[model samples]
Target: MYTKELFHSWVPKVLQKIFLFVLAIPLLVGSSIYTANMGDMYSGLGTYAETLTFANYSSTIGMMVGLGVILKIKPRFKSKNIIVFAFISLGLLTLAIGSTQRIDIIVVCSVIMGFIKVFGMIELVVPIMFIVSPKGDRGEFYVVFYPLILGASQLVGFLTANLAYNLNWNAVYLMSAIILFGCALLCIALMHNKWTAKRMPIKGLDWFSIVSFTAACLLLNYILVFAKQQGWFYASMNLRLALAAFIICAALFIYRQRTAAIPFFSLAIFTKRRVLTAIVLFSLMGMFTATSSLQSALTSILQYDARTNATINLAMIPGIILGGFICAMWFKREGSTRSLLFIAFSCFLLNTICLYFLISPVVDIRYFILPTFAKGLGMALVYISGGFYFASSLKPTELMGAYPVVIGIRSFIGTAFFSAVFSWGLYQFQSDSMMELANGMDTMDAWVQARGGGMQLYASVRTQSTLIAVKELFGYTALAGILVLVYILLHPFHHLHRRQLIIRRKRLKGESIDGLRAESFDGKDITATAASVST
Candidate 1:
């Protein structure tokens, strides 16, 4: 969100740009490092759900709070100084996570790290948003930013995963801390806060909504992540607390938002069909078509080590770069929002089909190339088109509200919560498949035959069951892609047909067609204007 003017007095152009770049890099690095090392962390902790939930839930809450803080609070120090503090804090916490063996300690450190990470990320971008000239190649900068971080994360993850393999899990995190320390140093050296927002006292702040929402998110995340492993109703005391807390906090959150003088969430945002649609599309894409799920499938089922899997995943980087370029060019040239959406959906559909055909327990690494590439392309197209569409739909001042709501809901909660759902489904499917296979082996000979002559029979069955479960998951993902494709296709039809109907009414009224002109929504005319909206 751009302020009416630069937040504080302008600085030298080159120095300001440099500060923005330096400030921006750390948050991406911290995020990438954490994700890259998650597998090792999970192994050390010895539970997938618990490890992931513990690592992610805090970060999500922190981001949500940071979003609010950025909008509400104007710090006394320059934005860059706040970022420097956060970077130092993050570096220390990362080191702590590396050194600590106790899960409880790790969890506490993670929460603290999350708080810092949010401030780091929010402050990191402050200069870019507030100081940089709006006329600069901002679109191009963003076009490069997303794919670069994504590809670099994969590369860094590969390297750290290798470190984990050769040395230890601690080695992976130690490297991360060292790298973060370097980043902190860079921030300290290069970043200067020449510009700062005027300090404003936060007025009419709904503390209850903030508390309720935070509690709801944390509790619900735990409940969702652990429910399958811990059992639904009767397994663990933590589970009971998670469920009760989630329900009570969630209700309170909703009520507080409704009653607050300034609601934390404006329910009015959902009234805009396009905004709501974009959120749904992005959320589903984040969930069912998640790259993390695919990575887990490669490692856990196909038994490819992280290094090899990462190399296979390199195929995606090219696609991401190409897709971002194409999307940017299209927006600059044709500027067809509808067409961009169609392209995104088409790529997603192609990715799903490619994956459906490619997935198998014994599938070769080469088989992943096309599908991953397609997904990367689809991801870029969706983010570029969907992001532009969402931002443009709102008034410029509404950007702050949009950022937290969209990013928090679609990226953080959507990814973590859906990944949990997928994990739970995979476990259920594996269990059911294993049971079916075991039951079908009725006779001794049949059992022996099915078990491959009693040499690691159960292990063999588990592997097969896991493979089956993954395939079923892919099938479901394909179905979701189809639904998205249909939705994207149909959404634009109403607007196009309505325009045509208006044109016909003007003609019927004997209005001059030659002099009648209308502004295009994007740069492109609706190609499907002749098609009936109802169809």
Candidate 2:
């Protein structure tokens, strides 16, 4: 009986803070579970590089539609408060799905994870944030609680990722299942909710948007999964898949949204320029940092074993926490977002320097730990600040639409594009280096003439040779970081304009005379509490 509404009614300070900490636990644990599962999820699909790309694509699309489907289905449920109950109820199912690795199982888990995210983490933060302090003290909450919880989550996740890399990939899934179940238990024991939204019945389904969305996602997934094995357009299957998917998506989106009662996506949210920019920036940064392929650099180029690779990432905990802590303080005192971003960029540069010069078989784990921390520091700066950025920019009324779209698009598009770009680069260098080594090899003729068992011997040589050639490919990541830096500096705001905008988002509150958050789509009138935004 005591849930979101009960927590909201009259929970006292000491109890509320305890519940909020408990609320944060599942999220932290969930993130760790997610990162760990991802570390091995695609191991069976392809090479380390290919596996990384496939996992990114699958996870992104699964996440995007998970919310879309939930939004559509939730309004149709008859039970009052079903939104809250429906989300939390799926916990064990998530455990089951995560624990199993069959495509069917993983697919199920991804869908559920996406489904629960809306009412679970996103909304919970709002209440916990508002209740944690007096109505006016937003900046302090961000400075203190936000970083601590986020750092805790990412640290656990970072630890899990490394541990999985060393253990069997299957261990990742099992661990995630255990963690998720534990979180569910903790939720029942400790979480206090303060839900106010009434349940909505699904009047009509957005069949058009749904089809379009599915087709678009499926098409993209096909491209990622089978592209290497089948070859791009040369594979008749790829061409057929692309053609079929694009047509369905194009035709369905136009035919349905103009006519449906509840459209899956509102076209209106993109109208806000600042919000749009923020979305793009957020996506790019995530794509740049989190792709599983980055692990290849640590494992392959650095010539470190899985255990060592995991250890290097473990070192990131302090820096990640430090960066978030610093940014929150910066936001409270100076209210300067640009300064926060500038700090992120500077740390990024230092990280790139670490990679540019230091990647070698001779390089010890100690050498890279600082660099890892520096990179993490950059991530911490942008990430913690970004949460505040979204809360401030969008009113509560528009929250679901604005927050999900920004998070969804940024993650999906950024992941797909970056994975494609980085993999292509890795492939090209890998191909070239192998060819060069093969041409120079003294045993080339004999290797080519070998049969059956001889072919196996040749394969081993090829594997070893290819690993050696990947040195050039490893160097490309540092270059990619440089490219990202250049692009960020080129943004029109560069520094001063961005600084002012961050302050403006926080300062103006309701003064945004344009009714900036007033726009509505999908029938919900979205608005944010000044208190909520400040938090």
Q: Which candidate number has the best TM-score?
A: 1
Query: Model 2, 164-246: lDDT tens per residue?
Result: 66675556556655655565555454434433444556545665576577667656655654555565566567657686777
TM-score of each predicted structure versus truth: 0.84, 0.74
Show model 1 residue runs off by greater than 4 Å. Answer: 1-19, 46-49, 129-133, 136-141, 191-195, 201-205, 233-241, 439-443, 446-452, 492-499, 502-513, 524-535
Off by over 4 Å in 2: 1-13, 28-63, 66-90, 98-101, 132-150, 158-205, 254-262, 290-298, 301-305, 386-392, 444-487, 494-535
Q: What is the C-alpha lDDT of each candidate?
A: 0.66, 0.55
**Mind giving the per-residue lDDT tens digits that candidate 1 earns over 462-519?**
8888778877787787787777777776776225556666778888998876765655
Error of 2 at 440 (Å): 3.2
Give lDDT for model 2.
0.55
lDDT of 2 at 162: 67
